[model samples]
Target: MGKPTGFIEYDRIPSPVRDPLTRTRDWNEYSLPMPVVDLQIQAARCMDCGVPFCHTGEEIKNGVSGCPLHNLIPEWNDAVYRGEWREALDLLLKTNNFPEFTGRVCPAPCEGSCTVAISEPAVGIKSIEKAIIDRGFEEGWIQAQAPQKRTGKRIAIIGSGPAGLACADQLNKAAHNVTVFEKSDRIGGLLMYGIPTMKLEKDSINRRVNLMAEEGVEFVTNIEAGKDIPMAQLKAEYDSVVLATGAGNARDVKLPGRDAKGIHFAVDYLTQSIKDNLDNGGVQTLSAEGKNVIVIGGGDTGADCVATALRQGAKSIYQFGLRDKLPDLRAIQNPWPQYPKVFQMDYAHSEAEAVYGADPRQYLVNSTEFIKNEKGELTGLRTIDVDHVDAERNLVEVPNSEKIWDAEIVLIAIGFAGATPSIFKDFKVAKTNRHTIEAAKGFYRTDVEGIFACGDARYGQSLVVTAINEGREAAREVDFYLMGETFLP
Candidate 1:
């Protein structure tokens, strides 16, 4: 325990943030640095409960009750409280491959299911985590742990997203010659382009990738497994193969006037904005300046679009969600220790409110079609309010609720359906119904003899933590399969 009465003595304190008005003007991260002393105080609040639901990492109502990584939360909390930061980092890295990435971007399901959150605010799990890892970097505690002996087994991992990176990190620990192939030009796949730089800085990815390189893990970018290099060649060269290609088949909004010039998928828009920010000398090439932006589908991606649009000087922005506004508090079906499925404002929401003077989300509404001008450029949208028939998710359009909304640009942020199927060809790997690789009923083994799959390629679009878990487990399974028994964890 951090302290015997620490929970009672201290209250929760979140990480400080920059004022939204000032922060939205730049592409840099907005989270202000937290002092180590203040973060240590917050870490002291961990109660170290007997059961410690925060570490269970179980599935509850499709959400994780605790950390999917099953991070040694309480143990690290104690270490942090005692100011043993190096020890804390060791504990954190024992399970997670990248605490810094998760600390910055992850939603922190651990906090939602926190025992303290049943009453008062939850422990500052995410903030404390961030503090620990950041301090580790600053103090030069983290270093490459190159394996003493090579197993002489070569492993090829396709896709360099969280799943692929995590899998490569673990496989490297087993002394396997791990080579990561990324289709994109950069090493971090989704971590690179999919997420906006304002939330997670590019240097974070660069630092980790460099460290992995020093650890003897070979990274090959701009060389897609199936297309650039034939899949059969990879299978022939590597003793074991892991398919970690993330679920990138973005779900699109099927509406009339879909051929309009200004309509774009969330990934395309986000990627373009990131690329512009990186390549065009900090200027947005796809600027939404002086435009009325209508964003369809409300989620993290939609919120990101809103923030990106605001930064690009959009005149007005509206994000639409077909679902009704959620209750402020947890519902009957939701209980403590299960991630609270209640209304919340993410970083982009606060930024939007700062710029627009209100939350821009329009709930229980549907964009019927994209309204286009004579030039086929999207000038607006025709929308209608919707009502779900019941919890079963039947929908009906409401009469007299139709309205025309002005928009120069429309972005669809609905989320992804599954992985692209073309890449799995030539390898002759079986597939599941969800379009992911077909693994053994309870294992990561695919139909192919020595091929395995994990992360979004096996389980569809999931959180970074879940992807890390999949990669770690898949590596363990791969080790077991190769050695006929294994010691890698």
Candidate 2:
């Protein structure tokens, strides 16, 4: 789909990040932009494979290959290769509503499944995507696209995160009057608060939100749908309701003295830190200043805590994980086309190591207890070295391998437990065994008529791209339910 010999001539080029030492001092986005010429060269590397697996994003059971949204990778790659920036933007926006957010934050499963990755590195598909969209914005090619006519229908969207926003964007384009309800004081649910600004600057979110408003989508913030406004009122007012409240229930690290004063959930800690930085113009409250910090759970959330702590002037940081470390290269069972299961570095991990002079992660360590001081403040964490054993390979502590980690603040970044029931208290929507909203097996409809759920609330915690896909799908369903048929793509 690209130049005939492009893959053979051009090597894969990675997007570069700002200097770690300097970037750690602020919360601004740390990644630098690539010039369009270099980006086109990267796009030229897409080889003409018999079939494209980059965007056949399905249940992903076989492995994490294919784009969940089934993004038109080859089409857009060819456009970028020809310097057809506008065409590339149109193709990208066809599947993804917010490439700007995904460009900065998404893990890029698209690259992992790229046909070229079978031999050489995949085409710089993601970078080309970011470049195309960014170029579109720079040249004022993107604008508020109001529908030509009104469908005379209304849709109420709960939550302003990726899913909520995507659904709102689609439903609005279908000429439905859409109102997005957010419990927080601002738009962009987790996108606004849970994620650190450096990953996705709030300015970008504000810009899209403002454009949505111009296009006739209403955003109401600081109002809980169930508590502030009853579900009955919304049901009576809107033709359909979309519940996109993300799965926000944080998984707890069960250990003695779990209620220690310094213990914090990863999302809450990150939210407060980000809100404080945005509102107060600096990290005021929840500052990690001059304190020994121990972060439990070595996932993306944990990595974020480490970076936040670094920016807050932390004394020292340590991330503990009960699971064994991954291999540097892909294992035999983990083959190509599947998302690479090899050990890799993220922005926060790189920044932590560069600034702290050491990798902050320690694997195979299980936290057994939290040691607190006389006043009930966290002082340290007691843990034990463990190994995987038994038929289930459950973690087993090694005898005489106990150790106490010195710390003042402990951030639990163990992940989420799906959506909580209290938010759905009024809707009366049933939940599945996995604790997510119960909808059609292959659709976004709920048991209740005219009610729908998508994104993390329905699928459990997932990537931003997955959420966008679900939202779009749900909007299509809602539109069909309203009009008895829909032109929503």
RMSD of 2: 1.3
Candidate 2 regions off by >4 Å? Answer: 390-392
lDDT tens readout by residue for model 1, 1-489: 878887898988778888998999998897877887888788888888877888788888788889989999999999999989999999999999999999998889999888888888899999988888999999998898899999999999988988889989998998999999988888887788978999989899999999999999999988878878887788889998898888878888888899999999888898988888778887787779999998898788899899899999999999999988888999888989899888998888899999889999999998888889899999889999999888897889998999999898999999887887675675678877777788852379988888888888788888888888899999999888888887866
Which 10 successive residues of model 1 have the least lDDT summed?
A: 419-428
Model 2: per-residue Cα lDDT over 123-207, one tens digit each: 8777777777788899999899999899889899999999999999999999999999999998987888887888889999999
Candidate 1 ranges with C-alpha deviation above 4 Å: 391-393, 440-442
How many backbone clashes does every candidate have? 0, 3
